[model samples]
Target chain A: DAGVTQSPTHLIKTRGQHVTLRCSPISGHKSVSWYQQVLGQGPQFIFQYYEKEERGRGNFPDRFSARQFPNYSSELNVNALLLGDSALYLCASSFYRGEGQPQHFGDGTRLSIL
Target chain B: AQSVTQPDIHITVSEGASLELRCNYSYGATPYLFWYVQSPGQGLQLLLKYFSGDTLVQGIKGFEAEFKRSQSSFNLRKPSVHWSDAAEYFCAVEDSGTYKYIFGTGTRLKVLA
Candidate 1:
């Protein structure tokens, strides 16, 4: 089966603009999570959605939001983009059987803010 | 909050030499630990994970990690280094009660020919 997929592979936006990033979970996966990775650092959790319901959220500001679709696909939306928001946005999908299932990641979308 | 720490920011080793990368985590409950590797411009790939059972867990690409609860460390090791192993390595811990995954800053491995 194909791995988790993300799109726009790359994006560029201006300050105060809003951007939406999309993710398609692996087939049969029920949970999707989003993470933000800055240069020279590991990924930080952003949000997690299971069965189209928000399950968890990270410490990001209210400007950041996400939603999962009925098919388990997810979209991460960031409002009021800042230069600091320029980073690699990663999407991961998991089976979410009970708990602690491993997450499979996508290559990630590189978001740049000007 | 829970967190992961990789004391080494970068490591350089000669090909064919043994390798080791250190990781430490702070959490309240029994931790679920994992090791992931990322090539440049690529996403992370799981190397291995530790939830229960044997403390020493073997993973893909001839890598293994030993989880020591007393020390709160899950250290990754390889018997012989390969140039292909040059990349960034991250240590992550799953939140026992949630889907949160806390990751370390990452240790970049530089393999010398």
Candidate 2:
């Protein structure tokens, strides 16, 4: 079974520009979460979606937003990108949004803000 | 507030030597703990987790972690290290009643020949 898949393995954008990173969860998975990993730092949770509903959100600013489609795929959108936004965006999928399931992650999209 | 801390930023150990990484968490309730490994330029992989029951949990790649609630720590250990064990290890904690998780800064393990 293929694990979570993310598109645009790498992306580059200028300040004030907007960008969208995509993710497709593993088959039969119902939960998807997004995280931002800055250089030399651990990933910070951005958003989590379960069953097409916004289940949880992190401390990220309003500029960061995400949504899950009916098919369980997810998209993370960022507006007015800043140089600090340059980081690896990771997508993780799990069977459910609970304590028992371990999230499976994608290779992630390396986003660079110029 | 929930938080996770990995005291060591980097560690180097000779191949075939024992290895241990430290993790500490701050939470009010019973915390769900997890260890994840990330290779260079790759996503994080689950090494193991502790939800309940046995405080000592075994994971893939011959890794194990002992959770100490009294000390609020979950430390990962391996009997012998290999070149393949070189990676960044992150310790995460999820609140028992919430879906959120807090990850530590991570410990970069370097295997020496």
Candidate 3:
């Protein structure tokens, strides 16, 4: 089966602008999570949704939000983009929100803020 | 809060030589440990994971990790280094209650020919 897929592999936005990144999890997966990776750093968790409900959240700012559809696909939304927000956004999926289920990742969407 | 630490920011190893990357995690409970590799301009690929059972767990790409509860370490190791292994490696931990992963800064491997 195809791994998790993310849309708009690359994106450019200006300050004060908003952007939305999409992700489709693997077939039969019911959990999706979002992460942001800056240069020279590991990915930081943003949000996690399971069964269309929010399950976990990281230390990201309020400007960042996410939602999951009934189909288990997800969208990460960021408002008032700043130059600091220019980073690669990653999406991961697992069979469920439980232990022993390693998440599978997508290539990620590179977001550039100007 | 749970966290992961990779002391070596970058490591250089000769091709065909053994390789080891250090990872230490801080968690009160038995956390799920994982190792992931990422090539330039790519997402992370799972190298291996350890949940329970034998402390030594094998993963894809000839990678293996040993979970040491006493040391709070889950260092990744490979029998022989390959040029293709010249990528960034990240160590992460997830608490059982919280499924979110806490990742280390990462270690960039440079394999010399």
Q: What digit string (tens of lDDT, one per residue) describes model 3 on residues B43-70?
A: 9999999888999999999999999999
Which 10 consecutive positions of candidate 2 chain B have the poorest summed lDDT? Answer: B93-102
> Candidate order by DockQ, highest to lowest?
3, 1, 2
Interface C-alpha root-mean-square deviation of candidate 1: 1.3
Going through the candidates in order, the fraction of native interface contacts each one reproduces equals 0.75, 0.73, 0.83
- Cα lDDT, model 2, residue A80: 94
Clashing residue pairs for model 1? none
* CAPRI quality of model 1: medium
Runs with alpha carbons beyond 4 Å of true place in candidate 3: none
Q: What does candidate 1 score on TM?
A: 0.98
Q: Model 1 segments beyond 4 Å from truth? A: none
Model 2, residue B42: displacement in angstroms? 0.1
lDDT tens digits, residue span A66-110, model 3: 999989999999999999999999999999999878999999999
* Docking quality (DockQ) for each candidate: 0.76, 0.75, 0.86
* Sort order, TM-score high to low: 3, 1, 2
